[model samples]
Target: MRRPHGVLRTADVEHGHDLLPPTPPTTVGVIEAVATGSPRRVVDQRANAARVADLFADPAQRQRIPRIYQKTRIDTRHLAIDPLEPEFLEFSRKPATIRERMNLFFEHAVPLAVDVARRAVENLADPAEEIGQLIFVTSTGFIAPGVDVAVVKQLALSPTVNRMIVNFMGCAAAMNGIRTAVDYVRAHPDKKSMVLCIEVSSVNAVFDDDVNDVITHSLFGDGCGAVVIGANQVHQPLAAGSVVIRDSFSHLFDDAEDGIVLGVKDTAITCELATSLPDYIYQGVDPVVSQVLARNGLDKAAVDLWAIHPGGPRIIEESARSLGIPPEAAAPSWDVLAEHGNMLSVSLIFVLERMIRDTRSAAPISTGVAFSFAPGVTLEGIVFDVIRS
Candidate 1:
């Protein structure tokens, strides 16, 4: 007699029983596609160093410019405004006010966002109507209705699209945006969501003699990146080269509140980065990652790709060493830093895009983890499996 449905026979179990076939890993959602864009102007490190040197009248601050910038390991960056332009020069000579900077942000942020958003949604089954939610993340600037409203208008996104703007979260904001998107798509598996990260760091330039100001000026660049996320159902199969997001982890370190501070000064936004920030990350990363892997029933050996944020040279280096990730696994982070400087929250998406694209030609990255740091000395990560086919 045949075994009953949903039942297994004792003799079959005692013998070699192939009761059921293996099932695919369940996922919150898949990263369907990614698109990135930058402003027209390109600023190489040498030119940027000269520009920084020009802003400082003090001998001490001016002397530290080269070494500080060189240590950042950035080669070229894109900026919204040309440093030599009259408006930029005027602002540098006499720093732009908060109002002026916000105006610049409003101008550049929307267009860049629209461009990348359009590219991101082009391959969707219904580019305009399919997106059920829009999550926008930015740290450099903000507006009343913000970039999300403009994106809906410009990209012709669904008028009723649910919108959330993640502002002032600093470098690790993208993970928050992705987390939000994942939650939405998982709940509404039939609809898709988008995470847009735009940082026009140039608009927040601080032309001051302070060493922290110089360090901030040297490391950041302008960029916009977007990722479309959706469920892996038959009606909306995972995109080619897409990665199925398995799980995410977020942690906030105690007594590290001041590790990174973004102050809204009268002149413009100012950033204070603690010298010990890397040490905090080094000590904190292992546990956060181990927890992420453990929850997913995995370990370091199971992770084949790592997409750690390049906060600067040291942040990425320390993060990799702490996680026991090989140098080559961290190369994409360093490459993005060198090519685009640190685009704040937008940078990690670039690293993810690079890794996903690289899989096309070379060996596919099967399992991967992406993580980043933020102001609260916060650590965020996502575990995923590459769908190379």
Candidate 2:
């Protein structure tokens, strides 16, 4: 059956409350630049796949777990600091019990973040006055004078520029940043916004031999992605196929907080990701997307592009299967995962930037959906249409 347009038939929200206002006719431009701190080293996936097999040589783990890990298609990952080195490992084990690992993590993470933010702003042709807001998203590390303050100092954005800092939310937090910027543009159509996401996933490493922790250690990489979004007046024209923001929807699953969590224990940060994540996505996303489309008076078939967070191979596959999206629709996401592992919140934007660059053909109106999952078992989605020049 064909689904109704972007209206809500679901029980979550009643019909009378004020819906978010439509995106203004004003155009928003996006500039994406990525920076990494990993040593100039690369990991070969073919060899790592063999190593994984050898490590989990036990019968059951070898059979069931290795198959799932192999599906991630991650050949090798880059680390801010090598994980195999004795000094790093020793630091992970004990650091005089006085110097906390969180402090050490922040020391390495903040500078990289500042550098990426500067590059993104510097790449823009417009003067600093053109950017009205700056939003920073990160879950990897925290410092007193955070990215918001750091970015302002480094980029020299105007003192009047609005600033927001979002912390602790995991991989999907970037969607929240985009949603905030979209709302900012809608309210003040002439204003521009910048979003910077930096995640030093290596810092959060648990240094444990547990299978789940090992899997996480192997899957995440350290990277930062920064983008500028706002009126195009002072910036380069958005490329021919750039994705434009239209609308967004967010849903938090009930009683599922325990399913995914990131927290600090002793001097190390630990991530607890339940194996049931695939099941959560399978159960919730279909209805959520349907409701989002219904509100915009759009049907599922109307969506022409999909930019899903490359959380992992199984999560991506489950999302595709649940949404009935073709493999081609999610190819960019897969490519991001293969090339960069999960850079937490930055991964979605990385994939979206690629889609915007690759799309060429035109239709009446093309809609793209970007979705991500994180702690709180939250599923956030944004729907945007291509703006013709």
* RMSD to native, candidate 1: 6.1
Task: Name model 2 segments beyond 4 Å from true.
Answer: 1-41, 45-69, 95-100, 123-126, 231-241, 359-365
Error of 1 at 22 (Å): 20
List model 1 lDDT by residue over 1-389, tens digit each: 77565466787678767556545444468898899999988888977787778767888777778888889889998999864566775776574388888888989999999999999999877867789999999988977777889899988777889989898888889999998998898778888999999999888776546667677878889999999998776334555588788888889998888888888877787678888888888888998899889978999988878898977888898898788776567888999999899898999999999888874444444788998888898998789877665
Candidate 1's TM-score:
0.89
Minimal lDDT window, size 10, model 2: 30-39
Candidate 2, 1-389: lDDT as tens digits:
77564455545256542365644444444333333333244665555444544545467755554555566688666667665556766766663422355576667766777777666667566637777888888887766666577667766778888988888788888888888877776567666677888777676565544567567766887777776665443234555555566677789987788767987666566677887888888888888888889887888888777888888887788888888876667888989899888878988877876766663655634578889987999998788765445
| Best candidate (score: lDDT) | 1
lDDT of predicted model 1: 0.84
- Among residues 3 or more apart in sequence or in different chains, the pairs in candidate 1 whose N, CA or C atoms overlap within 3 Å are none
